[model samples]
Target: MTENTQHDVIRRNPLLEAAQEEMRKFERRENEFRRKDREERAAELQLPLAEIKVH
Candidate 1:
């Protein structure tokens, strides 16, 4: 197959696009929850806010 045709095939892959979108959403929610959980734990332990990284 031609290189142009191969590129077109990859660009038109709906399944890959959908999976990537799902992962983006999942990561956003995961980070949000993780940050909240860390904040709660920090408050409980009286730890400084500078030590936790949710990203």
Candidate 2:
């Protein structure tokens, strides 16, 4: 048997997985809010809304 570094192997980490899930949820909600805000602004000015650029 041989020893390997952490980054050299794939493993399941519950804590990291949970944190990633939370970030995904946050991003989805933020995108939704940005979409609505853009739409409302466009409506106020009588213009088409532009596409949102997600980072």
**Index of the highest-lDDT prediction:** 1
TM-score for each of the candidates: 0.66, 0.65
For residues 1-55, could you state the per-residue lDDT of candidate 2 as single tens digits?
Answer: 2345554443546667888999999999999999888778878988744564535
Tens digit of per-residue lDDT, candidate 1, span 1-55: 6999989888889878999999999999999999899889989999888865545
After TM-score superposition, the amount by which residue 23's alpha carbon in candidate 1 deviates from its true location, in angstroms, is 0.5
Relative to the unseen true structure, what is the C-alpha lDDT of residue 7 in candidate 2, on a scale of 0 to 100? 43
Model 2, TM vs. native: 0.65
CA lDDT of every candidate: 0.89, 0.75
Ten residues in a row with the worst lDDT in model 1? Answer: 46-55
Which residue pairs show collisions in model 2? none
